[model samples]
Target: MSDEEKTPEAPLAAEAKTDQVPSSPDSPVIASATTESERESLPDLPATESFSGSEPESEEADGAAILDETMSVRRLPRGLIAQILAPEDETPVWIDPKRLGRQSRRDFLLFGAATAVSAAGVWWLLPDGTKQQWLSPAAASRIDSIEARFGVTGQRRERFLGRVLTFDDDVAEALYSRNRRVRAYRPSDVTPLRNNYNGRTPTGGYLVSWKLTLSGLATGKETTLTAGDLSRFPVRDQVTRLCCVEGWSAVAFWSGIRFAELLRAYPPAPAARWAAIESAVNLDGAGQPDPYYVSIDLDTALHPQTLLATKQDNRPLSLAHGAPLRLVVPMKLGLKNIKAVTSIRYTADEPPDYWNERGYSKYDGL
Candidate 1:
């Protein structure tokens, strides 16, 4: 069985191997041969010039040219025929193994970089992606959306900013810093006061004629006192700056009795946490009687700098600058320094303020 049969395939196997290799490595390898005897003889052409003629122009080879050039191309098939057929720019040179390797590596790096950057941007834009100390991610995203034209509008902007303002107010109270006082400057540091009357400006000279009313005392009684009665308590003065909600400030010298001493003379009822102050009736620009009123927490009423001022820069109070008595609380913005000889009523709940009702902050603290 052995020797004859085994050797039978040997010669033909070697011949098949050699035949499978095309003349040009770049061209398609054609036709499989099951056995050497299956090979057919190609017919000799009618007659044609040998390709040994000047190699035809590398111009496009049509079907006729393909038959004529088949011999030449087989002799140098390394894409020569393809180059002739393909557009100059689309010539399949990029398919070369080494060049394709470099192009693929460069493309892979660029694609990876772009994908990573896009993913990070998407993460930051998501509402819950980041935890921040000041602005929440949701707020940040809304702000970004508004700026980036993602459909957020001015009304939405206003709503979020209102929330931001509320949060801003909360941050100050969170420190539990009621005891922290403002820096007091020297008398020489005092500057001229700026006129910032809201609804009405009083004409000068209510001094001596003015009286202060105190109500809702612990005894449930009300008392009235003149500016002179306030001098019975500690009369003190300090140079302090008055900051306004309108973003301006003035330093001034004010002399008055410490409001704490006044509270000692007439303590508020046990449940009272706020003191409401009202000015003598003053008319508005339209000539209507516009009331000026505000409230302060009892805690603020107790600060050392809280004063019932009867004088400024050594002169008696001018009615235009709140004659006879004006409450001076430097820890608050200029608005809290209620003007005019007025009444102070103690209450358990905050009283409605003139400006607060008109959109100013209730706690206007420094």
Candidate 2:
């Protein structure tokens, strides 16, 4: 204990000479010689030291004060650190990269606000107007209520109810179909009159009368026709042929009354059988209603010359020919003759005739 105090203090003589050295079985001995100078300046130290034990510097300062009291205490368990930072029933949990970039910018602003509300609801439901086929304000309010109740003006002639009708060439191809400029009034130019007569014939005294009326008769009932019911209905002269399925032909002189005497003064109901009629002018503007509408069969509305005219040749009937009332059926064709008779439906089916629903040929009678 005297040769320099038994040769010790060189850092306690290198910590008691590495605590009496004896570490080998493939070495890993660090018991602190200042942790072997921090494991030899950390060149990843390890070439051998096999640890055993000894005061190894108070067991390396009580194992570095129990690893600094287990790294300052509070180890895990707040539900295991919220289940190891949350997901592990076999891995997924990543998200929080700032909530996945705020949920992909709130799903790209809700897919650009649902594609701008589906392109503004398809430009507010389309359809505007310019006439490629326009007319739906209830078919332009039924052609402005039949040209404000049957337009009338002036023009004079005088013939009323003469008879003997017949026009041919398939009634001039159903009233001018392939439109060869209205096939020039075929059926040999014209000459077929008398149908239903309600007369007053005195030629030059200018009194050609012949009236018959029935405003709107779709069963909603409303009927009127006087002048003593058109002279108590008898003068029905016969000579028919106004055959005009557009092809055109006009003998002219259809008198009045007889739509089987105004459908027997408003009868229709033995399950009727169809007889649409209705006209006033729009013919094809797509806005429907005009000297157009044709559907028949109630055996041609009780046929005995099916009329409702109001005079044609001697006078009275004028608004371009279908005055006040017009519908003469001498076996049809001439679009079932409807012209300003407002309404008259008695259907047990088969109605929709305007040019047979536009494609033509619905018997269109002879």
User: All candidates: CA RMSD in angstroms?
Assistant: 23.5, 33.0
What are the runs in model 1 whose C-alpha is more than 4 Å off? 1-166, 176-178, 204-209
Best by TM-score: 1
TM-score of every model versus the real structure? 0.55, 0.22
lDDT of model 1 at position 194: 77
The runs of at least 3 residues in candidate 2 whose Cα sits more than 4 Å from the true structure, single-residue gaps closed, are 1-261, 278-292, 295-315, 323-337, 340-346, 355-366
Candidate 2 local accuracy as lDDT? Answer: 0.50
Residue-level lDDT for 240 in candidate 1: 86
Quantify how close model 2 is to the true structure by its C-alpha RMSD in Å.
33.0
Least well predicted 10-residue stretch by lDDT in candidate 1 = 41-50
Instruction: Give the backbone clash total of model 2.
Output: 30
